[model samples]
Target: MIEVENLTKKYGDARGINDVTFTVEKGEVLGFLGPNGAGKTTTMRILTCFMPATSGKAKIAGFDVFEDSLEVRKRIGYLPESVPLYTDMQVPVYLEFVAGLKGVDRRDVKRRVSHVMDDCALNAVSKKYIGELSKGYRQRVGLAQALINDPEVLILDEPTIGLDPRQIIEIRSLIKSLGGRRTVILSTHILPEVSMICQRVVIINEGRLVAVDTPQNLTAQLQRSQQILIRVGGPEKEVLSEVGKINGVSRVSVKENGADNINAYLIELKKDMVDAGKDIPPVIVRKNWSLHEMRPVGMSLEDIFIKLVTEEKIN
Candidate 1:
């Protein structure tokens, strides 16, 4: 329920974001990823109505972000990278304050605060002042305030930036649970978080949109060749020479295996060489070499991300 078209934001000669365009369908969780100084926070601030774009257009839940700021704000709950909170306010009191600011009815504020506290696992700290809470608890309090309004869309920027592994998992689970009920735009540099939590990803670099696709699709699109790892107990040179002759095999490299007389071979095949995996085993067998193991090495999200960013810089 979000649409952005050629969104551009700039501060004098320095570019914040340029020609940034993407969409988040209703109930879709979109991961917004980029390296430092890549305009991720700039884009999110524009989407959440915290700042206006220099040009282009955006709509949230069908309301124009620039023209209908109030309507857009009412439909979106934002947790910025640095969450703004009243340190002296108690946990529950903070949420109640947020609910009121978001226009929740006075009578329903109590129930709404309670529901968000439970959702964010902040019930135990309900009576504690935000200033006295741990960083993790403060993060949860930030999230609880974001959800206090039960908005149709959630815009979270680095929701798990400083938490421990356990706290990160808890927050990740909470974000996943919100999917299908609220459209979410999660902005973070954490690759695994994008892989585990996002349905699709929008990657930006150097203030430009670099790639946008599901993680699996992006991996497939960016992979230039197929890689297969094979270990064999045989003469290294002979094995490498024979494997190189197989149809569709483009390149091969051999590394010394730890096991005695065993060598590990990394074989690169032509793009879309689906049958090469099956073709190489027989070649080794013809030479009477004992095959130890064979498996494909798929490119991970991190690999694809690095490749995209590096390529963008080169071009």
Candidate 2:
């Protein structure tokens, strides 16, 4: 539902985003990830029509973000990082006002406001002034306004900022539930949140598109070997020596020494090696050692993000 090609933005000499190209499929929830000053918010603003890119093109729901901004805005809801809210207005009143601004039918404004309030769990604070609400509640109010129009696309920038743990989970669940119904571009520094809620991720760094793929796929692409963590009740040195000799085991190191002679070892196998979990157990048993746990460990999303962002510096 959204397409951006070679989009570039600049504030004079400082480039916001350069040659950043990606597409968000209809009904897809895409995570936009980057470190601070990585142009994530800049890209979102261009896509949401909050700002124009200096060059290149962005289209939302088939309408050009620059040429048909009004039509594009009509089909998308945006919750910026710093929500622009009327502190003087009551929760429901503020939402109702936004609903009207989004061109919701007057007859359905009340119903839309009520529905979004419930969806955002803001019904209890419906009568409370936004200025009086807590930070978390105000963030919810921002989200409520975004959904008031039931737009086909939602561009949420740090939608969970300032939310408590419970509120974070509630908001995550709400965003996840919207996956197949609305095209969402979620920008946040929280890596795990993206892993849980986003179908795919677009990672940018230093104003350039670094990588874009499913988390699982990215892990596979970046992983050069299989890492297995195993806990065994045996002499650490002997177990390490024996495991190191096992076929397909390229390297082994003691991760931790536990009480009662139990130890955790991290084993690294060659990329083409046989399954370490299956091969290492029988060896441990024959050696009269207790096999407590064996599991393959893959690179996490955070690891992938770090690698993608730092690979250039390292190289």
Candidate 3:
């Protein structure tokens, strides 16, 4: 439901985003992932028409963001990084005012405001002032206001940042529930959150679109070598040497131990071949080394991100 092509933005030679291009399908939740200063927020701002790009084109819900900026604005629900809230106004009052500004029919304003308040779980605090509420509640109020117009697309930038653990999960669940009807493009550095909620990811770095794929695919390609950690009660030297000699086993790395006892080591294998958990235990048993503990070290998304983006920098 969103398309950006060669969208470039610059501020007097200070780069914002360059050569950025991507699209989000209808019903797709696209996770915009990158480190800070990676131009994620910059892209969202351009899409919302909060600011125009220096060059290139973008369309939201099929209308050009610049040419049909008003139509695009009407179709989008944007929860920017810092939700601009009228701290003095009470919840229902603030939303009602927003509804009028958005040109909601006077007869339908109450119903519309009530509906979003319910959806965002703000019904209980509809009488509370925005400034009096905690950060979590204020964010909920921001989201409530964003939904006041019932826009078809939701563009949330770091929506859950600075929230406590409890607040984070609650907001995440709320965002997930808002799916099916609204296409979402969420920009967050929280990798796990992206994997959990997004159908696909658009990873960017240094104003460039680096990679776009399913989280599973990205993690798998970078998982070239697998490693296992093991602790045994018997001869560490012999067990380490023997595992290194096995077919498909590439290297052996051991942890430092006291002079009299050494019981732990890391075994590396060709990632595609050896099932380290199934193979290594038997080897230690055959060598008469009491295998106290053995566990495979699965590759993580963080590992893949660091490897890919860091390599991009060097090249």
lDDT at 288 for candidate 1? 90
Q: Write the per-residue lDDT of candidate 3 for residues 101-122, one digit (tens) a residue.
A: 8778899999999898888789
Candidate lDDT (C-alpha), each: 0.91, 0.91, 0.86
lDDT per residue for candidate 1 within 1-315, as digits (tens), equals 999999999999999999999999999999999998899999999998989999999999899999999999999999989877899998887788889999999999999998988899897987799999999999999998889999999999999999999999999999999999999999999998998999999999989999999988998887789889989988877887888998899999985565777888899989978567789888888889899889988999999999999989899
- Candidate 3 C-alpha error for residue 20, in Å: 1.3
Model 3's TM-score against the true structure: 0.89
For residues 158-195, write the lDDT of model 2, one tens digit per residue: 89888899999999999999989999999998999998
Clashing pairs in 3: none
Poorest stretch of ten by lDDT in candidate 2: 270-279
Candidate 1 structure lDDT: 0.91
Model 3 Cα shift for residue 18 (angstroms)? 1.3
Count of steric clashes across candidates, in order: 0, 0, 0
Error of 1 at 187 (Å): 0.9
Candidate number of the best TM-score = 1
Misplaced by over 4 Å in model 1 are none
Better of 1 and 3 by TM-score: 1
